[model samples]
Target: MIDCTRAMETNDAPATIAVPQDDALRALLAAIVDCSDDAIVSKTLDGVITSWNRGAEALFGYAAAEAVGQHIYLIIPDDHRAEEDEVLARLRRGERIDHFETVRQTKDGRRIPISLTVSPVRNAAGRIIGASKVARDITERQQSEALRARLAAIVDFSDDAIVSKTLDGVITSWNRGAERLFGYTAAEAVGRHIFLIIPADRRAEEIEVLARLGRGERIEHFDTIRQAKNGHHVAVSLTVSPIKDSRGHIIGASKVARDITERKRAEETLRRAHEELEERVRERTAELSRMNASLRQEIAERLRVEAERTQLLTRLVLAQEEERRRIARDLHDQLGQQLTALRLTLEMLNAQSADQTDVRVQIETLQELARQLDQDVAFRVGELRPVDFEERGLRAVLTDYVRKWSKHSGIPVRLHATPSTGERFTSEVETMLYRLAQEALNNIVKHARAECADVVLERSPEYLSLIVEDNGIGFDLSSVGSIGGGVGLLGMRERAALVGADLQIESTPGRGTTVIVRVPAHAAATRIP
Candidate 1:
């Protein structure tokens, strides 16, 4: 409602009006134009700029003195010059334009977005003289609109359900994500109670959430179950935030629901697997413990049996020695005396028959037979038990035994005795070693067909060793059990064990055979009496 003629001061105005009335009207029009925040200007119908206000100077970067009397097209960009012609044409027809938004150039050639309101200007007779234009800047409004459009696009395309509801728990807005998640269209969901998607038993949750939202509290990632349109339960994680109005008052809430059904199922599977693994571990541990206990019992039983066997072997050896001593005593005391008396009787009979030649020859033959019987008895006694072992030490016994064996068997025998071989040991150790050596020589005579043999008795700081070696036709050691000396070897090993000695046999075909008996010094010293 501005006076266009007074604002522009038209040169064609009449000079007959009262000066005070004109001055007051002109002052009022100037005040209205100066006080407006939008740019206000008046232009002649021919597109000439007639007047400009302070607002126009600020908006278009021009002062009143610089913009007045200039062409209105001076502020119209080259591409939009036809817009000014159209406005002028409309004004010539006495028309007004309301809120015509367009781009206009400033004095510095910067383009500004503005909404223009143009009206035809006239004098008191109502004849059109010029046009008045109002331009308002709308840059901030355009940016806000673009931002809103982008946010709407994101909400519509999100995978998670995004919904907005009033503080009363009634849904106000539903996006595409919400429609897909709940199996409902936006039209069906909007205006409905938000609890429609909650399970019947859990509907009370909505009341609680609404109360919190009213207090402007945000609930983040609240895991819960809900009902789908198909009436099935769905696991979801909900993040609900309070929606505020321009005055900062809580009016509603925005909820984001993410589907977590698969996640829950996977977690349950893992938990079950862990439980099963723990159960298996417990069962296996119990089984192993039982097995370990059984093994301990078995080991104890084996040790007991071994101890009993050692005692039995010791008693058997003692009985054997006693039997040998009894046999030797019988052969020496009874058989030797009888043989001596028989030899003496044969000699006296030969003396009594000296005059009878035939009788003398028969008597001499009887005497010769008696002498052979006595020698046989002595040999048998020596073989039964070598009492020499008790009287003379190991070295003397071995030397006499080996020399007699070599003479009887027609084989060369070499005997090697260490200096300590003369030292006395327990009867059991000496007997065991002597038996082993005897068995070895018997094997060489029966199987080896050897030309020469060696028997060695050596003593070390820790052990006493007896070695019997023969240069004979050897046999495969691997086939010892199947070969000729199986029983003999077993007997040797048994005797060695009784004395706590280690016996080893080494042989190869056509090479030689060697038998070694190694008795620890302490074991030999501690043999049972």
Candidate 2:
């Protein structure tokens, strides 16, 4: 180094004996400059390139041959030409420019950031001749500095408390947010231990945090309690990360704390409210369950009562039928015999008084009266339920019944009956059909002022339909319910329901009335075609 510096300072030219040593020293210095990554060049006071190294060629995208003997302005951008001129003027005055940062263009006209260190170059006379320049690309350094400044600004202005701490638990940096959150200035907090904000009960937690940070672990959203400077406790969500030095070694910890006290209180209140709601729901469910049980019991009781009533009604109807049979039997046996005897007695009297014309005529009149009386008694017996109904089935009983009803009511009846197949439905079903037929005939006699009625009994594979149509002074069906329901409609409906049959009544004023009863095959039809 001394020999190179002495060569640059010498006033005289090198002697022949010293040429080998000087060339060796020159080659060594050239090798050093070529090996550098920065651009190294020497220029005259007028900005002309005097020397160019390989480092300069690589940095500006130019070879030594292309750059040598060229003006230094080849690499100086247009905007910085004035700056370069100033540099040259400063070099003329023997001034050195150290680390002067600026922009410079490349061989491809690309602009880059550079930091230049210019020193005065002198000849052997020790007189300043020109300047030697070393320029380093500082793009990465500038970018890193800008990023750091932006991050610092963000931390300082953030609402969260951001702080850095040493591995030994000492606070190294505290932002404004920490001051606002803890009620202490950054100056008062930076030099203190981390425990200044950590509650005494949480010191162990802090120790664990520091230990984890030393292991290069990041802690995120750690919920814990921290103390404020005013002696109040605050709930916080903390995010802690390890701060590493340039050598990638863990040096400290960075913590970001967010105040979550209000959130915590809200969550607790919601939990309590939810618990209270669940309790209410449980109570209401219990109440509903009890109510359901009571309702079920009530329904069961009603069903039982209805069943009893139904049984009683069935027995009453059966009893009434039995009584009718008894009365009918008594009338047929007693009154019929008496009337027959009375007729026989009148005939004997008439035969004996044959010679007296008036006496014979009077006896014959009494005979006729006895005959009519006997017929009336027979009719009354027939009006009661048919004794052969169970044995003969519904069709036989209904045929006989409709005939008697027509005669008693003095109305002509058209009975279109299906031939029976000698099959029988249940006793209840037969009784229901017989009674319904009986009731329809009775109603027609009472209300219908017409001359004739139709009783149609139809049998099909699917149904047994009985229709009783009357040419009567039919009443309005809409008024049937409101006008006292005097047509025995309710009774007919009940009887039909007992056999699971459908009963429909159609009537209009001044028209005919039709009573239809349809028994489904599955309901009561004992035979299928």
Candidate 3:
């Protein structure tokens, strides 16, 4: 019933069985092949497929039923068929290939990159029977390798130094940036201690950085000092992160360092400039304070001088008043008596010469002449001083003066007096007031072309005031100094100052003039002996 040639072919087929002692072992081996992500296939020495696993069906888009009797070149791309021939030749010589990467064709006509391992299959007698091949798709692994290369290029060209060190502070990798920064090539720096670039005094920084890296921590922008190849110190800002292994364990540290020496120098310069500016401001303030103190002292000295001058003026005014009084007394007591005696003698002579017409006429003329001289002397004495002021009170003196002045000037004058407190003022104060009133009336007669005048004298608890007002053609008060009234106004002001009083003059053209003198109560009561 069986064909002998077909039976022989079936008996020569390679069996997919291993002589394991237990079913568990065999089941595990089967699981390994079926669960693998790589395609596993076995073929005859002549290249006919003998066995195929689930992984092979998934990889080549072919089922075991479709590929078991097929040639091994079914999955080999057309251009890569020569690779298989060489692979088979090596296998025939009992050679094994590991990770031989090449392109192979899937059932969909697309070529896929794969890594392959091939080995010669042996029979129970250790004879080479076929080749077993394992092919793994390597698309994602190739893409990952390309990305890593790009990142390495970026690190090499960075301006800031980029380096990696182990947890034990050994330098593992150094980029071109690190080489330029530290003046060391990667060949020289790698495998050396990372502290080689750190300044001697700052070696402790490396210890701390390594300690932190061991704890899987990142340090960002830590400013510290480092050393260049020339032994000069450089200020640097460092950022360090933990470098991890494939198992996510911290294996080393990655660092980026930027030089900041110029920034530090600029900060120091700005600090010095700020300090100098503050010092200058303080010095200027002190100088201004000194100037202010000096100005205050100068002003105080000027005030003292003004006070002394005022005192001297007051004494001089009192002396001048005394001299006027003395002159008035001499004229009244001595010259007045002499003139009376001379007039009486002339009258007696005229009486004796009554019978002689010529002698009587001459005696009468001499008597008349003596009388006129006596009157003239009395008038001059009154002009020199107010003798009646000493004998009479201020009101009486003022009344007599105003009456006489009104009679002489033919000007109507009114007087008003009110003594609120019956306090008699000092003689000096009374004299000054009388003199001021006299001067004011004289000014009215000379300067104010008016018809009527008024005099007011009042005494209050705080002060004594005298006002002399005239209903006359007023003059410009501002121009009074340039006008002829300046001298009289000056004298009035001087007298007011001597008695510590205030003098005010108010006037306008066509309106009237008012002269007022106010003496404080304390000053009026003060007697200057």
In model 2, how large is the Cα lDDT of residue 324?
Answer: 82
Q: What's the lDDT for residue 347 in model 1? A: 86
Candidate 3 vs. true structure, TM-score = 0.44
Model 2 agreement with the true structure over 408-514: per-residue lDDT tens digits: 76799988877752477766767777777777777777677878999887778887788988988888887676212232677677667656789998988999788
- Error (Å) of candidate 2 at residue 43 is 2.1
Of candidates 3 and 1, the better by lDDT: 1
Local distance difference test scores for all models: 0.83, 0.80, 0.81
Maximum-lDDT candidate: 1
Q: List the residue pairs that clash in candidate 2.
A: 9-124, 10-124, 11-124
Q: Model 2, which residues run further than 4 Å from truth? A: 1-21, 214-216, 298-529
Q: Model 3, stretches more than 4 Å misplaced?
A: 1-32, 122-129, 261-529
Model 1 deviation from native, Cα RMSD in Å = 15.3
Return the number of clashes found in candidate 1.
Answer: 0
